[model samples]
Target chain A: MKGLKIIVLAKQVPDTRNVGKDAMKADGTVNRAALPAIFNPEDLNALEQALRIKDNYPGTTVTLLTMGPGRAAEIVREGMYRGADKGYLLTDRAFAGSDTLATSYAISCAIKKINFDLIIAGRQAIDGDTAQVGPQVAEKLGLPQVTYAEHVDKIVKNKITIQRRLERGIETVTAPLPCLITVNATAPECRPRNAKHLMKFKHAKTVTELQSAVEDYYKLHEDRPYLRIPELSVLDVEADTNWLGLAGSPTKVKAIENVVFAAKDAKQLTADQKDLDWLMGELVANHTLG
Target chain B: MNNIFVFCEIDEGKIADVSQELLTKGRSLANELKCNLEAIVIGSKLEGIESEIAPYGADTIFVADDKRLEFYLTLPFTTIIVDLFKKQQPQIALFGATSVGRDLGPRVSSALKSGLTADCTSLVIGNHEDKKEGKVYENLLYQIRPAFGGNIIATIINPDCRPQMATVREGVMKKEIINKNHKSKVVAIDVNKVVTDVDFAVEIIERHMEPRKIDIKKSQVIVSGGYGVGSRENFKLLYELAHVLGGEVGASRAAVDAGYVDHARQVGQTGVTVRPKLYIACGISGQVQHTAGMEESAMIISINTDPTAPITKIADYNITGDVSEVVPRLIEAYRKHSK
Candidate 1:
């Protein structure tokens, strides 16, 4: 079997599992600086699936692609430590404030410049929770897509079988190659970073970071191509300016409110049958259930 | 020319409840926008399905019935929907945020270059004032959903995009009844005009509907187990209690991660969000991830050894004891009282 060329779309999102009072600003925008940024939880799961394919097929290569600010390049380095071969950072001032549509447009533009057999991404980003970009990219690229993927069962002669985790059950289906898949968190947890790969790719930096670095690493990057993270701006990717950033985004935030749930005068119940019977009776009377 | 369109999902030759809920909401939204409320049904042999939608106030029902469109292959279904959207320009489109809808809605929205808000808890027809750009868009759908892991609610609006779209959460909105005598105009389109053989890129090998399908989100009552349940054997008690209560079994992420249960039963940020009428948390230490899914229940009851478990804080009724002991007694009481 020919080695598969896989591309994993990863994102650096705010750790939403932990939110504080300052997590949201007065204007309802995320207080990104206050919250620590980490690789999107499910994106790690996507990387694991890609890495597994590379492990099973000896010569397969895994590439990481992420679109965010300059700091988002950290995820690229992180992916490298976890067995990705190379990474691309799509960063530009014009890409700010883009919603799912424009975001996918920009990402698709970058993807068009690359060659790959399969594209994989997390089912949804924790920050937006839209689960649109992966499929949207597939549509733009005119490729078939499978979402809610839990496992890749097998690949033979350009057909890939996937087991999807749905809300109610599992569905195992097969799609032809050159397809896109958005993985679910139910997939296997990503393997930890390799010590040797970490030491090798630790100094990998995007052009924006290398420009501001005080230490001279240009010679080192020239010697080792893997230490250089490719950076693409809107111009480099040939994206339309009108479809780049806030202008390209159609969704607008109307308002935001902080909701705090507090129950008043909750009834206390013992573990005995008397209280259970009363509780069940109250539920029946209120038509909560029969 | 602009109308409100709701994608009426079909399950086992019947319209799904979530579709009716969207129709109910779509009716009011159409009234607000002074346009017609239409429904799109794509399936095989979808006769008599129009009645289920018309009563909910759909002005027109468009059906694209074909044998190939029966089980929802992504390519064919997406092609049909996208072709319809292009021909019929809608001001706003609504979809039930179920498995089929979630998979198809994005593909359609992207093909049309439209914006879609997913898993919206509430939706309203309103105006959007862009404070940053000093622009105002009148008659837009305000899509509201929980953000930051249910910590806050954000209202999203697609101002610049046409055919503003949203997928509503299941069981979030109330389905209402209108005049039963009213009938919607039924239009049947030829599927061959749009869908071609090339759409069938994905082949189905084996499709299996779960034998004991546990639908926690739609269940009226849910009995959820947590890590404190200890072992796989202990989860049997939860299933027994849930059986007596006529409720489905759910599990927290901890129990699922610990290999005590399958992912389908998980209730948390990463799992299914449920709003059952009665939610009984058994031996579950309520992490924010778990509570985010079930806290919306009408009544929350927690039974745990640790009284200070986070779930107890929000629970309407708190019981301090071992679940193994309390659950059996509760089951016995329910069995006796009902008999």
Candidate 2:
């Protein structure tokens, strides 16, 4: 009924959707440069839900809060182009190699510095696939969280109704405002970038980006405050140095192996009935089926 | 003593297969560590749960059966699990990467300040060698999972954390019944001790389970479509083929995200991993994201217009033709053959 402050937690992940020969390095670490970085797929779904809320309730603002390297600022701009009112990029050298726990810590710290009535995020990031950061962030903020959210059905008074997609069925639950909801991939796809919004926010740059730009865009940023996308470092959020990055991250990578499926066990067959019958018979014989 | 723990999930009064799979894996891990394997079963009226998991290799079963826990509510479940973990202090904990586990695992791990790796495809005990980080942890749980959409398999380790936690996807590990006569020691905990009024924050207004839901993961045969399926309307052909075979229909992440099918039917790294007896892939190019989920199937039949499609390489039978035509013929042939 009243105005709302919505924050969509997003991430810029290496397009894990598309993998090439150089996708992984010899050491098994992802070759970030080989794959183009794009906004996390589900986060875009979360953004759509947030955008819908903004549409229903005018004066509501949707801000994207993404925590990654300096390159992650791109997702913030991407979010703005798709109608996010503003964005914040949480990046710093100390925040490198953060697992879900540490990542949530940083995001929660930044959230504390912002005004928000609803916190929305993707069920999980494609790169990590942990799906923990959203819930972990909610826990850190001491807020109720609804995971596997398919839709925000309605908001009556301070209570919000959500439809959750589960393996067996759908459940409709209600949580009070100031809660967290992680949108599933089943949610609506984000609206395409508005041409007007794209043109308006295309020039928006973070302080780190503005300083390194080839063009003299500092003067333009001064003239238009909205053109400036705030870059918040660890210190900006006043996060504890000890709980910022690898030090706070309890999970460590032991090794990475590039797995290629071998065709050694496969037997090619024809599409004819005889081959199909033989295959079916063989499966039954082997106890794979009956 | 350090022990291995499993969170046995119950759905519709039956122990989930994934939990049994974890118990099978946990039994061996506990043996290697020279410790006991215990399971936590939380539900109401769980009279036979102990006997149910007895053959799965757990030596102990902790049950928290209360009316409030009859259906899973996040806060209460997390509270009890956290309390039990703190009291028991198991060395490692495993959960099924399902809706209940995904919702509860993170909350418990975060509350306990422990690290949890989710949806692991493989679990092993090995030394963690991080040469770049100049650190090596001996005898750690090697939580192996496909990262970056199944592009690479990363072995995650919680070297310094207690109760190193991980959630494994269903069908990734085979559940072996060790002893049918085995009896697990049952220990019931009082729910009132750990639960509080504040834990009931989110209220469940309604729960609806769609009748005859297509559970592709458990289907004996799965007919999956991909980008080659063309459009949402064309997916009906997959349904027809699957129907004739008495199987369920599945879709690649591309197809699901394209609105061809529901996310529940998605089979990929981002979706469900299915080890069906027979997997018929139509129009799917067989990206690792798609293949990794169905790689363990007994047999793979890929139908694609492109002969050189990567899926063809791993497919036992690669039918190089248009799926729209091939599927119809196959459906008709199967119908006639059955009749």
TM-score of chain B of each: 0.68, 0.67
TM-score of predicted structure 1: 0.79
What total of clashing residue pairs does each candidate reach? 0, 0
Residue-level lDDT tens digits of model 1 in A120-162: 9999989878888998899989999999899999899999999
Listed in order, each prediction's TM-score against the native is 0.79, 0.78
Q: Candidate 2 chain A: worst 10 consecutive residues by lDDT?
A: A281-290
Query: Among these predicted structures, which one has the highest TM-score?
Result: 1
Per-model fnat list: 0.69, 0.65
Candidate 1 RMSD to the correct structure = 8.5
| lDDT by residue for model 2 (A155-239), tens | 9898999999998789999998889999999999999999999999989999888889999998888898999989898889999
Candidate 1 lDDT over B1-339, as tens digits, reads 688899999876789878998898899878878899999999998888888999999999999999877877888988988888888889898998888888888899999998898888777777767777898878788888877765677888888777899998666666777878779999998899888888988977766666446567777679999999998899999987776665789999999999999999999899999988689999999999999998888789899998888888889888888888889888766656441
